[model samples]
Target: MSFITLFITASMPILKVLLISALGSFLALDSVDILGDIARKHLNKVVFFVFNPALVASNLAKTITYETFLTLWFMPVNVFITFLIGSILGWILTKITKPPKHLKGLVIGACSAGNIGKMPIIIVPAMCKEEGSPFGAVDVCQSYGLAYASLSMALGAILMWSYVYNIIRISSRDVVVEICASPSEGFDDTFKNSSKQPLLPSADYTSITTVNQSSFSSRMQQWLTTSIDKLNLKAILAPSTIGAIVGFVIGMISPFRKFLIGNSAPLHVVEDSAYLVGEAAIPTVTLILGANLLSGLKGSQIQYKIVIGIATIRYILLPLVGIFIVRGVVRAGLQLDPLLQFVLLLQYAVPPAMNIGTMTQLFGRGQSEYSVIMLWTYGLAAVALTLWSTMFLWLVAS
Candidate 1:
């Protein structure tokens, strides 16, 4: 396919997202008042628990098999590298700009987790339909494309909920602690004052020894309790994560998959039902994204530089890194399908996941700032994705 044709094909899906997002934004306006904060929240809850999981499970059950899984092994690795590199960049940004403690997670998350799920699912199939597409027959291209997309969506959800969720949760807690702490009770003051205090006058040697032992035991018990509480696996195992897990099981296990997945299966209705519900996930998410942007536009104190920095990392630095990584993977003798390689490359270039906004809303921190960040990244995605995809197609085709 020519670069111009590829760019046109790639931009279609993004344009669809933008148009739906605009509708959402318009509906959220006070005059329209169709998708207000309360409405958006309720919709978000449904999407989070029901629509998202259903979409992920239904798609994966249909697409992934053991053979395809092996062929696409690099996908998970590619996603991990995006997260790792984005994180390193996020950390550097935090150090340089020193955003509020609570926003640290949001920043890192926005940097790390690209919109891996919907974009490729939408873009690749559209490209496959184009006359200039390099990938073979439409049905074959779409089938494989959906498989790659579904896998990316599933894995991305797991990583987002597990890794990004914890980071935001911890950072939010730290911010809360900071906000709640009184000046005199601050950590620095507590530590400095405690260190300067003279040692307790020696009591009877035996009494002192006993007291020290008791204190040590109490501290150890407290530490153990705190550690256990902090390692709350339930918090990390979010609905999306759970969905991904179930999807993987269904996809990888033959008997189970056969029973639930295909048209001929007795229980195919179960998959179909889930898929029907899951089909709503993309439009709902895009709408919520628009509604959230409305809020960001009204009033957001987020630094423009922070937003720019994140955009640069996600759109500029990461895509360049992805090109190298995909090339290296090919060089290392891994035979990835062209469409899959394009998906992998495009993954790096796409905007941050909408789930980050959901996370901030869940935590009640950085929602406006997050919205602002998302607004910019997604706004830029049309141009960014088109150009990068044009280049990626050219590179892969060569």
Candidate 2:
């Protein structure tokens, strides 16, 4: 396909996202009052707790197997690399822009995490269905594309909760002053107590030596508990993670796959039901995403530098880096599906994860700032995704 054809193919999915999101934005309007804050919140809960899990489990169960599973090993590594590189760029951005202390985490996070899951669920299959698509048959491409997207969503959740969650938390903790209204009073109290505590608590040298001489096993146990507590394992193993685990179990085991996967299976109804619920995930998430972004238009003023810097990091620089990374990996001898490679590249080019708003809401700060940043980044994403996707399709096809 020509570049123009590829660009059109790529734009269709993004345009659909924009259109659906626009409807969501419209519905969230004051006069419309349909998908308002409370409604979006309830709907988001459904997506996170129910729709997302079912979508992940069903898609993964149908497509993932020992062979495909092994082939996808590099995806997580690629995601981690995006976070690592984005963090580095974000740090540089912080140093240059010197945004407010409270807003620093928002900047880093906006730079670091992309909307890996939701965008792919919409984009990849839509591209596959296009007549000019280079990936084989439409149905096969979509099936595997969804499977790839589900895994991406699950992995993104784990990393977002564990990694990006902490960055925002620590940043929120730094700016917290007086007791204020927040989602968790207990969490704020912990932050307040830690803030008050001295960096090096005064202690007797004898007590220190005695503590150092304590049994290794007891110290190890204490260290393990602290590590787990800091990591927030509960969030790490989120509903989506659980769903992915269930899917992996079903996919990897031949007997389970036979019983639950195929149309002729004795237990196919269960799989069918899960898929039915899962089908709601994509459109619902896109709508919620649009509704949430409505706040960006009405929020407080933010530094244009921060927004522009993060946008450049996410849309321009990251995609270029991703192209090199994917091509290098191929050169190093790992054969990846054309579609898999496309999604990997797509991960780099997407806008920031929407969960940043949730973090700000939980912490009771920077809500306006996050909104302004999101408005611009996502507004620019339509163009960025189209250009990069066009290049990616042409490269993969050639």
Candidate 3:
């Protein structure tokens, strides 16, 4: 596809979703929280555990290939880069705006949040599910899942650790252990682990708006205590490590591959549900965003410049970078399928995860401002994602 067409394809999906959502809102069918509530109660659950896990498992079940191996490392590399960039940008953003130092972390956290879990789930299927995607594209998740899983391990751990360490001022070891123990950390516990619950009935999206100093302080204290109480690396890694090692070992044995994959094995389940739930991940994320909007955020927190910069990075810079990387990978003899390329492209296209706001809150950064960033990015995400998907499809088609 020509550059113009590529952009058009990318932009259309988001536009369609937003246009429809706007229509829905105008019709007064539901409030923001109402949508969020529906997402949490219905979509979030089915996707997170059932869909995401199946997706991850299916990707992991395939035989290891050189291309898939390399794709595995890309995400952590991106996360590390994003972290450095976000920190530097945070420093710069804080210097120019001069919000209280106490609040500075929020901006970094917000800008730095990557769509770790959702990106792969949503992206892998979209681009690869079709014929002539990057690889045979049948196994596009091989690329997306590994990258997602690798980064899921890398960044999820880092984000959780950063939250515990900076916010609680805890020992590094303790943070690692806590993250490993908590299934939310990606690997260690990962999405496949039954240790944690992805969608909780107790959740209250409205509470996201309670972002004042007092609330921040309260959260910090809670984080510190949790970190202190939960540190246990051996125990934490035991379940997931065992599951991963045994599954991979059995898969490589060949005789077990088909039988195991078709059966009730965790890996098979991961793939089955990941494709299904992955579809819902973005919408669920959008609802999360909508919930915050309904919570009544303020203007001062939503700086226009920051919002523009973030949107530019998310919609523009990230995908452009992915394009270059994809071309480089293909030229450089990586042999990645086209669908995988699309999924990788998608990994970049997603909005920052909710963790950005949480990290800001936990660490005493620009909690207010970051929360606002999350709000706008996600507000735009529902439509933005659809628009991007359409653009991607057209790009490949052309």
Candidate 4:
């Protein structure tokens, strides 16, 4: 089947669900019955701490051999280039399309090249080993792709910050001050507009008389007063950040290296817990994606052109970009195995992320729009991706 035909056929059933929900939303019927917030909320938490951290932890776990480090260095460079491409394309496309001024931010904000975290079903099938194999082996370096994705996360940060920078980049200051001043970008705190809070006396150890004391006490009080800011960057960065610290300590204790993953004690409990939470990542995201879809289906002033453009870029252009990148890498005589090629291209095609909707909701943009676009993006992505994978079977494993 052709890409469009395969996409539409594969997507029709899912399309029905979305259409009904969108119609219901358009009709102003209660959407929460069909759509629930539970999934979004749960996945938001998991992504923030467990899922994202595990991603970082797992990717960074192996010793950074010269070979791996070389790959790591190029990873950021690739993302910086990809970000430039994505941002410029999105900006120019938005300009020509001329969405509303308020929605200009939304349009650019809503679309992205891809997410750092892998969507295995979307990617793996396109890259899996062929049905019959001599050794029953498929080169699956999930970590390598994921590591590149982590850098994608940083590049994504820079891109989004560039957008937000439009709103706040007046006069810069010290790096530490800027980090402290950066607005909350993740869930729960995206809507924060104020920088001051009622000081919890416990979290802040200060006396009332200190307000009238010497300049030293006054400075201390000022520092304490001003320091309370968004806790999310710390929250999201903490798990992996802490994990790295722990991993380093483990590395230093070479004598005890065997004890941790060894046969004797087996840190199986901790291992199991991480696996369980990490496993929850995908389904939790899908469910939230489902609910977000239901809600969006309820209401939208969607431009069909934008939808098609996003779908085309994600399933078509994005992978093409990857192919170009891969060809260049190959032409340079770098040996990137087949699975890696598929994984890299697949990352470029993975659907618009659900976390974006969460952030949009927190920022008080239209929930209706957020939900609807997600419905359309994921729905079409299902088909667009399938066809792309099938058509390019030579690069694909399965």
Q: How many residue pairs clash in each candidate?
A: 0, 0, 39, 5
Model 4 C-alpha lDDT per residue in residues 1-398, reported as the tens digit of each score: 34454344334423443454355343333444433355446545776677755544434433323355554454555555555565566667677777655455555544453554435322342233333221124444443444444434544454444433232122111134345443445433644534345546763456545645777787887777654332234433445455444443433354434444233535535533543455444444444445556565566886767766666666676678877886678679876555455545655666665555545555555456657767777767656666654544344332
lDDT of 4 at 144: 44
Candidate 4 error regions (>4 Å): 1-35, 59-67, 118-122, 125-259, 262-269, 391-393, 396-398
Ranking by TM-score: 2, 1, 4, 3
Better of 1 and 4 by lDDT: 1
Candidate 3 regions exceeding 4 Å error are 2-51, 62-67, 128-256, 263-289, 296-302, 312-335, 359-368, 379-398
lDDT of each: 0.83, 0.89, 0.51, 0.50
Most accurate candidate by TM-score: 2
Cα lDDT tens digits, model 3, 1-398, are: 45554545455445444544454333323533444445444654564344444434444555433444455555455556554554555457656766544555555544455665544444444444434332444554445444345335334444534442253222111233233354455565454676665664545545555546569899999998887655534332432233344435444566666555555654566445544543444455444444444332554555577677677667666656656665566679865454544555565567766544444444454555665676677676766676666555554444
Q: Give the root-mean-square deviation of each candidate in angstroms.
A: 5.2, 7.6, 16.7, 11.9
**Residue 57 lDDT (model 4):** 44
Residue 152 of model 4, lDDT score: 48
Q: Estimate TM-scores for all models.
A: 0.83, 0.89, 0.57, 0.63
Q: Write candidate 2's Cα lDDT for 1-398 as tens digits.
A: 78889888888888999999999899999999999988988998999899999989999999999988999999999989988999889989999999888788888988998889888998988898888899999989988999999899888988898998888888777544675567597788888999997666556667777778786668899999988887889989988899999999999999999999988999999999999999998899888878888989886868898889999999889999999999899989999989999999889999998888888998887899999888888899889888888999988888
